[model samples]
Target: MTILFRLGTAREAFDVSMTRVRGGTGTTGPPPPGRRPERRGHLRRIRADRVLLLVAAPALAYFLFFHYGALFGNVLAFQDYVPFLGVSGSQWVGLAHFERMVTDPLFWNAVKNTLLIAALQLVFFFPAPLALALLLNSIVGDTVRRFVQSVVYLPHFLSWVIVVALFQQVLGGAGVVNGWLSTLGLGGISVIGNPDAYGPLVIAQLIWKECGWATIIFLAALSQVDEQQYEAAALDGAGYWRRLWHVTLPAIRPVIVLLLVLRLGEFLSIGFEQFFLQRPSVGPETGEVLETFVYYTGFANGDFGYAAAVGLFKGVIGVVLIYAANKVAHRLGEQGVYKA
Candidate 1:
């Protein structure tokens, strides 16, 4: 009887300990109260948001099918790709296309032109939006501010073709400016077909068309700035310029840094249509960029493999630039396009 009682006590103790650990029966029971409801809540939320998920399905599918799927074609960079033979039967030339690209004078010229144009844009075009945003944000009247925004943003909606045509009408050799110059007994200056002025002209066109649209982002950032900060600066006897330097700029600095980092990533991809349409006017020496170079090489010269190599090289450079820029942003204590 004593032995049986001891064994029963030991068994009971074991069962109690096991139940405590399991929060119920020894083997299992329902999950702990907190976890089961939390899990159920998560599943419930997912079910509730099924409609939104359904709405997003098409866009997700498009990106998966088109953008991500197209990444597989990068293999053409290694192969001497032929359309007739397709990817499977193409002869692999390894790095031969890349080797040729490195030694090609035309390729180097395109790089030079691309860098020069990109530099011009970074220096001149990049700051225009910020300046305009500041000017717009200073407006005391909402009506005037909104009207100005609409006028500036209207250009962004215009197609590149329409925008280019409008610029030609205003600034081309035989256009409005030249017409006025001729009436004043002055020589009509070359702008449209002038290779020397092409860089500046491209920058001008970019600013006119896109500067206002870019300003929208800056303005949005500025809107988020605390009005109290500006008021405090004013109470401290800080003037407009001083307040702008100290308060306004600091508030939007993060946005500026983020945009700058993103711009660096896309530094080489200065639009195909813009350069292509203008290339004939300025000639390849002035206007050939990586985009046009790729197009001409692949479609015009039918050198698909070499073009793919150039494109792949460009993509690698972009990745490096974005990574470096993001690192710099993190070092400066700013969140860039992504966290470090």
Candidate 2:
């Protein structure tokens, strides 16, 4: 009892000395004078706000510079753009270029092709990622699922040239299939250089190249779904399909809507490189889209002003589409693409 008392006394003295040294008069007293409540609160708020601003600045600058800066350059569409004269010096054509665009048969053809390809993509390509994600989610083994994911994602890193070349090598005249067919004394398919088959081929290429990567977003959303909810549903006698329909889908629905809206914004942009490279072989009837139209008009036909107008037209349509898509998302009980 005496030893315990001495130890306790020593501890108290040490604590008292430390407290005095640190300017705390009592054990439960406030912090030192240098770190007052008002000043600390100010510093904390300042730091937090600074951190938030730092995080937000890069994305804001990126949009301002690339998106809005490019938007400013759209003025050339209204002017007779000249190489010698700057955008400021260029003559204002007002609605002349827009008039030309509407009247041009080539422009109309490009618009038709773009819409057809985009629709095909929406119908065929859009659902593939969700299907893939669902299939992946069903896989029980991590090793097998990861292996499949990696293999599938490999094609996304491949360039447009490489993807087209891969298609050519497999389906071209002297390709593997044709070579096998020749050995069996069979007829050759003329799909390689034909414009008629361009739509299907491009869609197929898009699937091969982008589907796996696209599944990544859906998979991420799927990963966040509550396992307990699935368990509860299963306990309630919900089967796999029921759980998926009721639980899994509802969880990932927001992401699906978000991706759909973004895709709608890119509706007018069905890959320039792919079309440009294939156009030479298949001709413009099948390969022509807004991007390619702009390229040919400005560079091939040497009509920069008309090409800019076509581009401007596409841009406006994309903005309208995105706006509409966002509105639809809001109406369907989902958060839209943007928020104030």
Candidate 3:
């Protein structure tokens, strides 16, 4: 009986192999007994996965309250909002704030600065993580690669305040490098708070802080690439660059395009904490962006209505940009943030 069972198994395996060789779908096994149990068990599995749902509850609630909840206050944009009078009591001025935004010179300057910083980040900071991931993936030594990855990823967990402080300590006028330059009788260079160099400095800070963290996705995508593809390419006389261009890049192109689309959606939101902390030092001329503009207009200057208008404007633009980017991604034959 055991010999008979073994013969039957071998015959089944051979049949499946022959089916695949004939370009069949390779699912030559017996059909499933029923689908209702699986359908019914989904709810039971959900009950079992309650712990995961509970873990995600806080984050879900946070976004619900802070993001969607705050959206109601956008009505303040069209009102001459007074803290004491509140949104309900405030007189509705209609498109006054938006009209002011269009004519405000400082607002335009802030927009220009924001665009400049965003462009710099897209051009320089965006590709740094991808390059790092590719280089790290090339390292064959698991121990060395893991050690290097850990060291690079550590900076991402640091708070923006801590990151800014570290930069100031190392690059401030009286800081370590400048002190050394002074000792060497070469004039100390100004970087931390210098307006002319602010763009590069901020981009450098972003790269240092987030580049490794960003690689987590690319590395995941790389790991999913079929090793057999690389082997086949090598057998076909493809060199390193050719194999990378043909195999590795094509495998990860979906992930790259998805990330690029998301990045473009938030092109106007450079950041708040790092720039905010350095704003006073660099002065508004160089450091002011949309976030800082909103903060100063709302909190510092008591122009809540104007600030709300600008914030709402940014949100609208963000939604539009995300939709447009996703459309472009679809046109290019890539599944973007969502399916069509």
Candidate 4:
């Protein structure tokens, strides 16, 4: 009887210890007051965010139906696609379209122009926003900075047609710049339709339209930088340029690198509307890009299969570029578009 009582006491002690460890009575109980169980907490969060999810539903549906659904059309790249025959009746040509694309001189020309424009954009246009952001950040007064920002950002909202017209009015042979030059007895310079100047003109237009918008991102990044770092650098006898080089640039280097990687991923897509509108002025030799090339090949010539093949190739290249860039980002110890 004594041994049985001892064993019963030990069993009771063990149950009490377990109850304490579990922060409950016996084996289980309701969670402590003001605290929710894990599953309940997750459900509560989902309920709280339902409004936001509802608001985003339309956009999500549009992408699902339009963007992702259109991916199925890529099979046309491998077939001799005929509108009358439909996808189901289309003759499968295997790699014929791809083989033709590989040997096409026009496609190579488009590629060359695309690469040239992309390089120019990387060298000149990419740095404009950063420089502008730095200038805006240096302003001491909030009112002045905001006013300047508003003025610069206005162009971004203008349509590409309006922007192109504005450029023509400002820089065309008979426009303001030429009229001023003619009054000064100087020869009027041709810029709008000049083949040699087409690349620079497009880059200039892009800078005017988008540079300010891009600056907003850099400015936001700059705002997150602690002012104390700049003050400390100044105290160490570092001048304006030195502080910028050591502190400001380093603070935003990650954003710059991230943008660069993203930029490279879309290197071949140098805007369709801009190039299509300007192509007539400079001719196809100078103005043709992959976007325009695809449009002309597909819609204009009704060679859908060839165009689809070219588009598929471009997409594959973009994917490769993104993967390579993300890998480089990981190597540099930065979080890229996605986690390593």
Q: How displaced is residue 30 in candidate 2, in Å?
A: 18
Clashing residue pairs in all predictions, respectively, total 0, 0, 0, 0
Which digits, one per residue and each the tens of the lDDT, describe model 4 over residues 1-340? 1112323433344455445455667346565676554556767877867999899999999999998877888999999999999889999999999899888999999999999998998899889999999999999999999899999989888888999999999999779999999999999999998999999999999999989877877898899888999999999999999999999998888768766755675576667788988988898999889988999999999999999999999989977886675555444432322232
Worst 10 residues of 1 by lDDT: 1-10
Model 1 off-target regions past 4 Å? 1-60, 327-340
Assess each prediction's global lDDT (C-alpha) against the native: 0.82, 0.79, 0.83, 0.82
lDDT of 4 at 23: 68
TM-score for all models, in order of appearance: 0.80, 0.75, 0.78, 0.80
Q: What is the lDDT of residue 229 in candidate 1?
A: 96
Clashing pairs in 4: none
Instruction: List model 3 lDDT by residue over 1-340, tens digit each.
Output: 1112323433344445455455686456765565344455767768867899899999999999998889887999999999999888999999999999999999998899999999999999888989999999999999999999999999988988999889889999889999999999999999987999999999999998989878887898899999999999999999999999999998898768766766786677678888888889899999999889999999999999999999999889978986676455444432222232
Q: How accurate is candidate 2 locally (lDDT)?
A: 0.79
Model 4: number of clashes? Answer: 0
Q: Per lDDT, what order, best first? A: 3, 4, 1, 2
The worst-scoring run of ten residues by lDDT in candidate 3 lies at: 1-10
Top-scoring candidate (lDDT): 3
